[model samples]
Target: MRGVSADGDAGLGIDLLDAIEALKSVGCAVQAVITDGVATSIREDRRARGLPRAEWVRGIASQIALARRESPNRGGRHLGFAQALVHEMPHTLAMLRTGRLNEWRATLLVRETACLSAADRGIVDRRLCSDPAILDGVGDRGLIARAKALAVELDAAAVVARHRKAVSERRVTTRPAPDSMAYLSVLMPVEQAVCLQATLGRDADSLIATGDSCGRTRNQLMVDLLFDRGTGASVASGVPVAVNLVLSDETLLAGGHEAAQLQGLGPIPAAIARQLVADAVDNDTETSLQRVYSCPQSGALTAMESQARTFPKSLRQLIDLRDRTCRTPWCDAPIRHHDHIRLRRESGATTADNGSGLCEACNYAKEAPGWTARPVHNPGRTHLIDVRTPTG
Candidate 1:
């Protein structure tokens, strides 16, 4: 039995070099696929087998994410996790190629690249192509240099942003979804909302419920008002101004403003904005024709009322202390309003333990669900802030 000669060909002619060559070929083909775009599914079953383009791309983004520790087989992370990264590209290539990112940010981009699959690289490239931060901050030349540097380091395994990853981060930038209804909704409802609305306007509508609160936000419409006011508020003692008039190229030139966008507030000039303010003040207009059709939804309306009202006496002191800042670490959002971890309508106690301070951004994340302020232990003992990474 010991002499059965179990090995094939008595271990005679296995070409190890040939096997290595084959692997190199396979890697090359895969690299091409990653660098180029993939056609959308022409057949449904094809879609079923592989991850959807979005999901596939997202899965490959693992490179950008922190590699798990104490896992089974980890050694500086083999390239097994992500696909598109083999090509060293991102959804926002043009921006990345421009040196818009700082050193810390370059590493962050590398991590993002780790998550994309070969098929998803095209998608990522397009998404990031025109990112203003990449172009403006990192600059095209800088991004290209960084991209080249990263290619050597990561083999195009991850994205490179214009800023450092350590500068600030969000939860929803890369993940699939975000959690909402946490903070601001629980506190200063109506008037603050009104002020925010007046200050930000249409852009507020586009804030994704559970995503990051930065980037070229859909809130440009909202910010434009602030920009207009920022440039000229001194003339009116910082009171909210109103503007009413048809905006045209001529008007834009007259007001020292230009085109801008985010998710909302399409476009209007500073001069026109000021003119509208003057018109509103002169007429004592509470609502414009558009306003009649643009009233807050029942949910926002109710929220506005509750927020405008005050923090219950029992909760005031608690809110004042725990939330000295926005409660979202690194965010300096003022605690203008007190919010309950759990809202009143949900039968939450109107007690000190139920309160904390939050700025508008965090408020949106929690307000909908009405956070659990206290029960087993108070919400503030955590002395925590809401900080998460972005998914999309």
Candidate 2:
């Protein structure tokens, strides 16, 4: 049986390699389709009226997103990569077609050389990827480092411009994780990020040296210090800002085991929610409770109304709580707009049933021609919306 197992394992390894080669072939075909589709869209737009070529190209990404089952933003990136590979980085694309390079490594090459002009990019691509042997043992980071060095040699000014542009785009974001935890990410310039980490490490070491570190590990101490410094709360568990905790009366009052939601985050254990409330009370933190009326059986938020066209702040908060994030399909961006599912001018009321939470981009996209959205009714579900894109 052991000998048979070894033979089976060898066959499985061969099959896995074949599968990878097939995936590489599919990736090449997908890129070809994307570039050809862009050309076709531009030619068709030239024959049409009113719509600019750029606007027509915008819709192409959405259509590609639908076909690929991806977000519109990711579809746009895919289109950009396809255009670069087909028009500028032919050597890298050819290597991808030959299965010498995978999609991710090819994307790294394209990204690292993005600051270079087309001619310079072509030069880098030819030097790095012209022969399969050039990348035989190189890993992702090694490939990126080599590509960056070539790009700097070809045009250092463009690299400087790219760094400046990237610095301007620094931001902080959060996402939920498993085990009732969440990740907070800061996207800053490399120097700033490195400095921040070093500062945290230094502080954590000093705390450990003081011999009152409370048995926490170095990484844990760094995290706690980060929280305390960011919030100025002295203690990591102290609440320095408003935190909206949504829990049912049964869960809060009785010993019900239902999950509760923390706004901007996702579901947490009911026990943890009660613990947070208890801690707030014990610490004498100023807290306020607002009643959020919901159907007892279905847990859907009760409808709130306004006579005005625009949503009021309270109603907007309700919509935000109800939706938790953008209502667009597959787009979980934090809600930035309280939208009327049906246009207000088209007889849509300013009420909870008619309102939805959408990110800024999704809200603007919905306003474009041929895009439509409406409320969906499901007896036991929370707020639901049906959105139809132009392609649909």
Candidate 3:
């Protein structure tokens, strides 16, 4: 979308998005060069996050430099994570200025657009991820804006989840300034926080605030979660495995440095762990699973889709408005993904109106009768509110 010669010369700023889109039209590689070049030159800086947009430009520039060397057709060789970084450019710049969005959210945007391969990863890093004008040409402007907003909300929850975990683990560090030590808050909808604690095997902290600074690190935070919640005497019914889960929860929940360990999950030992979860089965908690299984989504292969009559979109939006921290109504764990109610292949209409989001355990607990079957009162939209007073 920048400077291209009247003689059909390559534009300086176009990236693969421009190149590939044009290739579909012109059927030429040179045009790909022209378009791709124009896409990579300009970059935007998101100042609030302290990340400069120039890094993108530099990344793309590196690709251009490489192409000028070995691959004149501009093929082969990856730009490493730098190219992978291309997916996040727009949101990163937007987030730096707002502080409302973060890195993981920004990266989702970058990767979503990275389906094209005309530009090398190196080039993508420089051209598409770097340039300011690239976002202008993105299709479905409304969709892009809406998706970004959703990602921001999700990231905020993750941040809070991490913070609370940190406090529970004693990972927080402290240093006094003139007035006070710089404190961090893990803000969450009380319901979500409550659910996360249960998933981690802790009891509850209905009204958690910014505790000491030592709760910042991940390992410490998770350990603290276990210690704080399970500090009291162990009951006779409690199994050692349950206590171990408490330990694991603490180890996993602590945020910041130790988070990677939690995320890098290895194979589950099928013996005791599986038996524990399997034996845990008899209690039944399918409310959350069934709710999610009943929802809809974008990945559908069908003909006669769910067409809303009265309201264009279905009034029941499960994802937008969660009913509980636990899908089973009383079980625990923050929702991770949707468990389609109607099977995707059964010609089920793909819409949020058809399903709900749920955690894995509750979602898979269909062995018990009525496990996945819940009494969804009203079956449609009606405002539900609690009479409880605010704690936070």
* Top model number, lDDT: 2
Tens-place lDDT digits, model 2, residues 277-349: 8898888887788999987677888889999999999999898788888776666778999999989989999
Error of 3 at 153 (Å): 50
Model 1 / residue 172 / CA error / Å:
27
Candidate 3 TM-score versus the reference:
0.19
Supply every candidate's count of residue pairs whose N, Cα or C atoms clash at under 3 angstroms.
79, 0, 56
Model 1 clash number: 79
Question: For residues 1-392, what per-residue lDDT tens digits would candidate 3 score against the true structure?
Answer: 36543344345335554544544433222323343543333332323435554433333322332334422112212232133432434333333223332333334444433433323323433443344455444544543564444443435454355556655665323222332112333455567668865754332232233443343454345445554556452222233332111112222333222111101121232343334434445443121111122223421111112443221232233342343233433333445445444445554345544455455544443222222232223433332222110110
**lDDT for every model?**
0.39, 0.81, 0.36
Largest TM-score belongs to which candidate?
2
Q: Candidate 2, which ten residues in sequence have the lowest lDDT sum?
A: 1-10
**TM-score, model 2 to reference:** 0.90
After superposition, the stretches of candidate 3 with alpha carbons farther than 4 Å from their true spots are 1-320, 345-347, 367-392
Candidate 1 per-residue lDDT, tens place, 1-392, comes to: 24544356634325443444445544534433432332122223335756354433332222222122211122112233222333455433323233333323433444544434444534444444436544455554565565455444544434333233422442211111222111122123346558766646444444533353354455553554455555664322433433223233433345545421111123344554555545555755553421111112221101112242356543453344333445433334456566655566776554444455665545554432112233335232443323232222
Model 1 weakest lDDT span, ten residues long: 293-302
Please give the range of 10 consecutive residues that has the lowest summed lDDT in model 3. 383-392
